[model samples]
Target chain A: MMEEHKVIVELKQIATRFGDNIVHEKLDLKILEGERVALVGGSGTGKSVLLSEIAMLREPDSGEIELFGEPITQMSGRELLAQRQKIGMMFQQGALFSSLTVLENIMLPIREHQHISGSLLKDLAMLKLRLTGLPEHAAHLYPQSLSGGMLKRAAVSRALALDPPLLLLDEPTAGLDPAGAAAFDDMLLELHAALNLTLILVTHDLDSIWTVTNQVAFLGERRVLMKQPIEKMVKDTHPVIEAYFANERAKRAIRQELI
Target chain B: MNEEKQPPVISESSDGVQLRGEWTTPYLKQLQKISKNNTRHQVNHIAIAQLDPNGSRVLLELIGNEPSAWPEGLTKEQRGLLELVREKVGPVPAQQESVNLLAALGQQVFRVIRHGRELLEFAGQLSALVFSLIRHPRQLKIKMLLDVLQRDGLNAVPIIALLAFLLGAVIAFQGGLQLATYGANIFVVELISLIMLRELAPLICAIIVAGRSGSAFAAQLATMQMNQEVLALKSLGQDPFAWLVLPKLLGLMIVMPLLTVLSMLTGIGGGMFVAMVQLDLSPVEFIQRFGAVVDPIHFWVGLIKAPVFALIIVNVGCMQGLLAKGGAEAVGHRTTRSVVQSIFLVIIVDALFSILFAQLGW
Candidate 1:
């Protein structure tokens, strides 16, 4: 089933630089449709930067990126809009527009791309809010008033507003409590199953990487060191990958999994 | 697929009206148009050719958000999506129109009162911090104060000088016209010196500082507050006002008087130039007349207002910053309020000062 799936996002020979510092060099990644992939690395590994590059929020210094088979670097802004509509990105800080209520934030992207009646738009936005497990009252509240977990959910709802085929999350469960994080992971799984969404998440949480994702893309040396199931990748003896999973947090997650 | 153009169709079927084809967000308008003609509220059987979240939502809307009427032929995903929309979708609360005049007035009054209370509270706290710091002057952050002084004071010199010069020139040209007519051309010297020194110079300088440094302080502090740096300071057992507000207040207070003096000199120079050109008064004669008639007390009065204006501007800015809630938008809003409130208070205080000066025979 995985072999038959089409590539949703493709990056080849990507490079990112900030002045004299090279963040990424010759980085390559391919995300297939319906696959739950986690981009995991230590801080400064540029996971968020890589996620943004794939989301088309930021352009890599040098790379060829294709979304849904079309090379985005060569695509016109109009063409890119069509491709961009198929991808949704949630930032680490829950970058929901603080000025807008949660429901309005969800409605904005759909309203921009699709001409639906105001009632239908509201219903759709509400459905998105529900799908993310946010309370109905949360729909009317501004992003500022939301708790950390609710804010993340609101951000996810906004990301899912257009029902994008590909969902990208940057640390979706980072600030959430253990139960909230677990519930969020479950919601992601359910959404992925129901919507047939190709999920690419940048996460530091080992539990999220273990439970929410099917494949782990370990980023090290400014590139993906290995890409495989978490079960297999964890066992791999690659020194950088070993060093990453050797942390106390990773051990706790692994221990929990065994039980 | 060419199926993209095939909008959802409603057909009369044995299971009641069957809504078929893609009912996604993009095709919603077309679906609504067709459904409206067909009385889509009767759509009970959802024969899904394709369905997404938006499609499911539109389907629910067509069925009046009643999942009980939904047919059993749907797949688990389709059924789940449809039920999800039906179960969770709530009535969009009507946007509250702020049309009631009395309510609006009441709200405005409450806002002003609340603002005043917060300002008083902040002022009290600030004074307490000042008194405590005064007792331990060695604990003051001199480096931060000097940094703010350089930024808010020295960096503003060129713009202040240019504006003050132009202000003086305009005053001299306007006043010199009437003076020249009445054969009191030399009186332009007194007019320019008195207005520039006693009223316009300090007022204009305060307004400029309010626009520039006042807004900057509000924005910087608001961002810090939003980013939890203010809380972090408190967590570290440091008063945010001592760290953030004091340096700014001291800097502005030190700067405003010096800037006003600069403005006064430039204003007088501008008036001299205008007197030379417009009133046929030479620079030497104008200076001599300025020396003879321009009361030094007017200059003192203007200089005395600077620190007061500075205090009001900095307090308003810091208060707005600390009071800022929400995110980036609140920072912008607070900064605007800082500048506007600073200018308004400065003007009101200036007017009060004018009355006080007049009554005191200053």
Candidate 2:
């Protein structure tokens, strides 16, 4: 799979900082096409910051980021916008616009990028909603009306509105019951397969790590400590990686994976 | 870093253009010049080697959509580098057009009209809510109504009374000084009573409510908005206007008239004190003179404007609050806006009422 797949995202020497707090320093990563990558880190490791940078919502303090073989730093404003349109981002809080209905939220990006009429836009938005497995009645309701699980699914529907090849999720299953989290992971896998999307998610859920992602990028000490298959990552001897998977829950998850 | 060792070279051939070396921001001007000069020819090929993100962007700009083939003799690493460049470099920037001042002015006017339309629409919604409650009294939230009345009206009495009393004392003092020169100090009762009852009492009370209750209304709604409670209400299929805004509006309207009557009496009492201490007038004499000069028409005229001012204050405050968005900063902004707009509109409506009454020969 690695040999046949194309490189979709490349980060060379990325450095991110807020005032005196440096989150990432000289961080390098490469994400292959159609791969499911999970970024795991302790608090303040800048996993979300890295995800935002990849989404092109924020520029890294320093370093080069290339998307689909093109360097993003040198692209013109219009080019940058075009590149961003090809990538979908789902925020941690499911940042659906409060003023818009769920269907309208999905239609927003589609309408912004296309010159289609209102009816067709609504149809497309409804189709995306259906793809996310939301009930037909959920389309007319505002985001605040939905349950947390439904809200996340609505956000995912909106992210997939334009059918972008790349999808970035920040803490996709941060707040959920175990059953809901497992279901969300399954939905993610289903969506990835159905859309042929390259998914990069930031999460701290050990179960999510084992279930959803093929590769795990452990972030610590202001950089990605390792990027490898989750199986290889489980056996990694690095101190930070060792500490992370040393917990009883992690051990159980690893045992389950091995079984 | 490897590209830094070998500088990029741009050469034009019969078939196409070939770019080699580290293409970056520093060499952008040279690339621009080359592209500008070669615009006349149909460049069919763009070959890129050892290019960075910036270099790739410049090359993409230079090549436009005319490139027919990739760079020849490129290694796999170089091919990856070229692909990265191609991905980074997007379509050329659209030409900048000059701004038209008339069109800009037209847009500003259109925005103002839209704002006015929205305000009118909000007023209509509040009116509908009020009518709906009147028709179905059972639907009214009596508890919320009483709560707002307690908060906005009952709590406001002491401050409003004190302010009105002070205002009346100052008017009497000022009028007494002028009347003393003419040896017509006895007429000071008429002057204080007329001004207090006809204009000052209701106007002062309205302004106080606008500042106190109006600002409170805005801040309360804004906090609810920030907390997503307003959104929660909408999600629950509850009418925010009826549940939140109507009660405040009705409460203020009911309270304003009561507050006005209190203001009038206190203002007269204040004038009596000033008249007794400074003008050598007894309380009995002042009351006798006041009873003769002050008419019901003057009190009614002032009291009639209270509900209108109440409507303006509550509407402006609630409208501003509902418009609040974002976080704490936005709540603060809408609260401030509510007070300012409520006060401004209250004064404007007060002036219009004065004009209307004066025209009617009142």
TM-score each candidate: 0.89, 0.53
lDDT of 2 by residue, B1-362 (tens): 11234455656676566655545333444545554566555444444444433344445545553333543555555455445434332222233455599988998999879877877888999888888888988767789999989998999999999999999999999999999899998998999999999889998998899889988899999999889999899999998887899889889989999999999999989999999998988999999987887778998999998998899888888988888876566778888888887778778888898899899988
Over the true interface, candidate 2 deviates by an RMSD, in Å, of 16.0
Clashing pairs in 1: none
Query: Tens-digit lDDT track for model 1 on B146-169?
Result: 998999999999999999999999
Measured by lDDT, the strongest candidate is: 1
Which candidate leads in TM-score? 1
Model 2: pairs clashing at backbone N, Cα or C within 3 Å: A69-B83, A69-B84, A70-B84, A70-B87, A70-B88, B8-B20, B8-B21, B9-B20, B23-B55
- What TM-score should be assigned to candidate 1? 0.89
lDDT of 2: 0.81
Chain A TM-score of each model, in the order shown? Answer: 0.95, 0.95
Candidate 1's DockQ: 0.55
Q: How accurate is candidate 1 locally (lDDT)?
A: 0.86
Off by over 4 Å in 1: A1-4, A12-28, A60-63, A73-76, A248-258, B1-5, B11-19, B40-47, B61-73, B93-99, B125-140, B227-243, B247-251
